[model samples]
Target: MKEIKRDLEKFAAEKFDLIIVGGGIYGIMLLLEAVRRGLKPLLLEKEDFCGKTSHNHLRTVHGGLRYLQSLDLFRFRDSIKERRWFLKYFPEFTGVLPCLMPLYNKGIYRKSVFRIGLPVNDILSFDRNFSVSREKHLPGGKVLSKEKTIELFPSVDTNELKGGMVWYDGCLTEFQGFYIAALKLAVQMGAKALNYVEAVGLIRQNDEVSGVKGKDRESGKEFAFNAPVVINACGPWSRDTAGIFEKDYPRLFKKRKLLWNVLFDREALSSHALGLRSKAGFVYFFHPWKGRLLVGSPEKLVEKSEAETVAPFQKMEEFIRDINEIVSGLGLEYKDILRVYPGVLPAEPDGSFSGRPAFIDHHKNGGVKGLYSISGVKFTTARLESDRVLGRIFRHKKAISYDEMLSKKEICCHSMAYDWQPNGEDDLEILKKIIKEESVVHLSDLILRRTSLGDNPPRALAILAKIRSLFDWDNKKWDEEVDLLRKQLREGFPNQKPRGAGNR
Candidate 1:
């Protein structure tokens, strides 16, 4: 079976039941669901699949415990069902994560609040363990004593401490690998996916959208993909992309808010994911990720033009300051941040992120038929929302078997850190595998997307020559590719340089 490939000529030649305009997690899941339901879906990505805004996730598969604050049990249970789907389907890449939030008598963080809330959360999601594997079963919520909480995590603040709340959720062991696996399954099941294909505009026939007009980014050529239905699943760019329609319809996406997370070089502070409230009462999560600390979710309202991949310097500084204020003992400096993960989410009129996964059938709203756009809120529920919403359009009696889809082996991408090092026997072999099969177009695509080599700059810098040896680029092209890679890396860490790259 074909792993992800860029055969725009072949893809554009085929007829499709549906055309999806983004290759983020939502689009990927939608394409897979479309295939499982016996629909021919073609997905187009402007860049490498999941290499843009969608790649910057905090890696937590949320179960919506926070929604319990407002007694939004409907959403909470929906999150539980979705979280179970990930654990049950992708068991190898996802697992149960123990979550702890220290109570400090702050508004909702107090023990008295959770004493009643925990049991209700348990009662509502009682069927959470219904079909999941024995190893992946999630235990009910619990409230720990102040001393026991401190025993489990000593770094939490003790001033006005009211105890701790412990619960379980799912976390992606390998974020990119899990996403790529889904895409691979979609490809195997007959969904057409091509990256480096940009959607220039829509092709409409009177009151209906017949296809999408696209441009191949790899080659400067234009093409058309004709489908009965077109879906705009471009995450943050949905609003801007919808502008191309230029119809007298309601705006598909409202103003968006910038949400960011910081990956500190320090090791995990505790075995469980810790949620501590700042002096200003905003709660922040500092979780243990691959032996490192990952803290998140500083937010700001930004206009459509101002949405960017990196958070502003002052905003990030304030975010780190807030984190330091909550846990002064662990002074996390800016230099300690290895990477900054940023993305934008559709916000309420008041800039709050309290919305659900939303979609607009432009046919019903104001524009042409067969044109629909979706604005996704969370990654945890992308699969659930995709199935629920798309089922309305393509109804069938056949049930989708997760075992059949996930169990079948396909040629998928894997992290090359184990094999891409110096003196490794398969250094060249694995690099060739990624390039030959994984739709690699540039050196940065190989380093940043197909593998996790870019996660560690020094190691990636050291492996440049081996990577170069696999490609046939000469002189100017190699230098240009290296310069592009450096420019992309510098966006995350402005001060990052080639450290110890030549030492070997």
Candidate 2:
């Protein structure tokens, strides 16, 4: 928190080569890249970093095997490369996840098809596990007999259950830590970032974007940040952020698609992630992460404006019903859901590209200059997209090698903190360190994103009073914080109702 205040002062005074609005994964990664290449950069987030779409991801670094179905070898290669890069660089935060797809006597999901497809997948991602640690190595896909499938997923439907195909993909054990670690690295590399700051409008000169008009959410003090180039990487709020520029590019903004996932504590799905097709024919992932089963299928498109978006409670029930009806013997009920993660990603009305384009709309192409907006989709490819965006902006500049960037004296990149358990029960010391270093402005930021406590509501709420005391908040301040967190939890995870609601 103190560091954020100091950086805010510094940001107000300096002129940056690049100013990025939105501190989601894309914006964070872009800031890291810009600083690595010796460019002055500033990043502002309206809320806490990775508090939205980036934090609600399925936690998988997909290897693009899905693209093989469309015969898109280029995309397959790109996905595999990004997957391998993350596994190699952030070994502490990621690992290889075993994914299973049950085979039936049907189209695409059959042993015969996998027998051919698995080898093709292996050929396409031949170097997927190259130079990776032995424990993190992703072996080639293989077919499992029906008996073996039943042993792994005990509740498999016996009717025409031929077998299953197993493949390996990367999974993030601690997504929030990875994102914050990236931002910290950027800071060490001379990048400035401040959360709870919003770009309310654009500072323009002669119809060209020259800077940004920002308002500190806490202080309500407005300031202008002068920059030659400004990038808008707002995730779900892309449309609203673009509106600040006062430009009407009708197709420039699209309604965001809301993807929802329900977590079950029973571990009914076990360790492996299962790919199951719903009755509606949409593919849903059933994976066990951190002792919970996560399930979700087709993404629901939001009918309301982004600001008014909220996941209806009915959707959570629907998710449970859909999974139970399709997969036999797994009688999951609404009460079984421990939490719900519903997040949005921008998309065209026709559902084209699915918000994966990184729409680097250099407004010069549409009348306004020095302004760009990005629509990020997948979490797995954020780094790849950042490289592309910076490549275009700094095309002629001499590029710095990854090795050189790491060798810099100031860059102190470390493995994710939550990747391994602490040697002792030093909760107070750990909490104090997080509050001091991680820009924890709100109680939810401290619990939800900074620590693992937020995942378990009982434990989090039990320690709320202690956290309040540690922060030295008055009763009124503490109540306000708890109220804000309650509102957020209700909308974000309805199952984990307010403290006294007894919904659980």
Candidate 3:
């Protein structure tokens, strides 16, 4: 990993083949694809890499099994292909997660539906286990007896507990690390990826985009980079970014789905991810990760402005109440939550889950030359989506065999020496390396995104002084960063109150 500040001068001087805005997983994928094809690509992120929507996923490398509901085989295969890559190539950050969806009635959510669906799904994903390691290999789905379901999930509603269906899926063990690893690989493969760099506007030659003008958050200095093509891979912010140039940009963003996932401190399940329908009939995933209960997906649409931030306390309270009602044994409340993973995703014009990524060539659709925008559907298929976008961007170029480089396994930042220690005292050497290379402009970058300390509030608070000492931040700077992090945690965490007590 290299610091963006150190290479700022070179970055400004170079005329690159492609300029990608947004340092989320989608941007990272584009960077990787660009470099593999021997194209000079520059990646810019307004915040820390993977700090926003990309970091707050359910941690599942979806295998397209969910797409069966819509009978979308194209998306289903795409997910299976990407999931296979993660399970086979990045075993360190990906794992086989067994999921159980309990059947309660003789409707769509019944055992008979799964009994036929699982085998068909298995056939569709027949090549899923190809070249995958034994330990990471995913097994096909099977029906569980009612008694077995009761044994597995003691809190399951018994009114119509007609057994359950068990299926296998892949989980992203450490998303922050996994994303960083991908970016680092792209950097190593001759792509320039810079964090904390915001692309304020597009540099256009007449109607065609030439490059971008960006501001470095660390120094507050603005710089420019020239490129023939620019891609808007900003995920939820795709339309907003493109709006800088093209007005009436086909309204790429139809609706913003505010997806929220809550993590509880206490153990909610012994093992296996439990999929249950909420009282409102929406499917909720109750999965165990890092000793916490992860539940989500009773999605609600919100205004684009409010979609980027955390959900309101009232909404969170409502979610908690719904969960409590569905699984009375857990009896969870807002106080039990450790953190709330909140993010916004692009939806169909009618505000439905399209379940497929959208790629737009601004030149073709919006009449803006040399500009393109991509809105991804899910994290699992980001790589495949990037490949498709690249195919359109470099239309006639034959792809190089960079499989070996792309597939190389990497250790996530958290898995480095000193492990989960948030305080810098535990491992000074690794801490210094991270601070220097990973572009630590703020304390939150280190604690919240780069390390696991941010996941645990008390631990992050305990290590503040140590971090201050390690980074050599002045009192004023240290205080500012700490205050900002506290504010962010308050909004991001479930237990903490929103910014203004009177407002909430």
Candidate 4:
């Protein structure tokens, strides 16, 4: 990775085939596609990778099951295709999550309507030739009796409830981790990907994009990169980045908006993800993660500038409060909350969401002949989205397909089946011996980032003494890291009050 960074530094001093702005899922996916085609692309991010809406997503790899009302057959089909591809290629990061649509008397779609719709969805998926398993992948949906619905979700509002429907979908364990892995893969494939670098403006020549000029946010140093093709894949900021190029030259760009929110709670709702409808709109998927429940996604229109705006703390609290009221009306509470966040979905001026039909436009008349803009799409469908965009950009006779690297067996291998491995006695003994020799501080470093133990502080420190002896670190470094961790914990949780204050 360090070597890749150094190479990027050298490349930035010269011109390149393509330079991609934005390090979100879309940008990273495009970078990977370019690298796979031997393009050696350069990728830039203004913040950490997946630092925006990607990280803030509800984590459901949905198939647009609700789009039937709008009759967006194209998007619905695209989502189905993308969902299958993600499950096939990234099984280690994805899973077939059971999803329940709790039917209510006041809902938009009735039981018979859903029964008919499920078969239609299956037929569309089949006609598209997508490899979604009818038996295992979706199970074609089933009708649950009112008693069964209450049995499944004991806290559901029975007055409003009218049985339910069960189906299958996918969910990600760690949204940021998956994208970061993709970014790392891009770096590994000889692509230049730098985080924390801001692209201040476009480098134009004779009214076309030549490259970009920006400074390193960490070092406060200026730099320039030259490229024949510059792609704007900045998600919600796509328009803003395009404006930088359009200022000196006339260019075309459109802006659209969508919003999502994540609420944390832990009620005894079914383990399956739930998609429900309310008076406002469809509320999709309340699922458990890291000991908390996440529900979301209220769609609304907003100015492009407000793309990365955080939801008001009170607004988020109110959202959870409303859910709690519904749950409590059936019986749950507000004590379940842990956190809240907001996300944006960029759309086109025609009131169409980005990524469904896929947008790939190039500015041939601009000073830079190959300036392009690729926008809109969900994370699950990232690979397909990239394939379409790159196909337009390269105009190649043929390009590699995701299937060449991914297979059903490989996908299953990567899934949760391999996540929890039990080490034998010999391995455990070796680990203990290594820990005894290395010492606690070095062990802390190893376990914190390298292993998943850092998510829980108590478990993280429990093995510290064992790890301390392995590295043979004296007390000094151990104490230093411990103090640093303590400070980090305190700073990371500014709003959390100290325990026992209320009782006092």
Return the candidate ranking by lDDT, descending.
Answer: 1, 3, 2, 4
The per-candidate count of clashes, in order, stands at 0, 0, 0, 22
> Which residue pairs in candidate 2 collide?
none
lDDT of 1 by residue, 1-504 (tens): 677777788878889999999999989989988987878889999988887667777788988777887778788888999899988887767878999998876676778888898888888888888889999999998999999889888887887777899998889866767877788788888888888888988998888888999999878799999898988888887876777854422344566778877777688888998887777777788878766788888888887677376687788778889988888698888767766677887777877784686688887777788888887888898988888768866665253677776666553445443224745657678778768866788888877776677666667777787667788888799989888777665554324422322233
Each model's Cα RMSD: 2.7, 3.1, 3.1, 6.4
> For candidate 2, lDDT tens digit of each residue in 219-238?
88888888978988887677
The per-residue C-alpha lDDT of model 2 at residue 125 equals 88
- Which parts of model 3 have CA positions greater than 4 angstroms off? 1-6, 305-308, 406-413, 416-419, 422-426, 492-504
- How well does candidate 4 match the true structure in TM-score terms? 0.76
lDDT (C-alpha) at residue 454 in model 3: 59
The count of residue-pair clashes in candidate 3 stands at: 0
Alpha-carbon runs more than 4 Å astray in model 2? 1-6, 250-255, 306-309, 352-355, 407-425, 493-504
Tens digits of lDDT, candidate 3, 233-268:
888888878887565354566778887787676775
lDDT values for all models:
0.78, 0.75, 0.78, 0.60
How does model 3 score by TM-score? 0.93
lDDT of model 3 at residue 249? 54
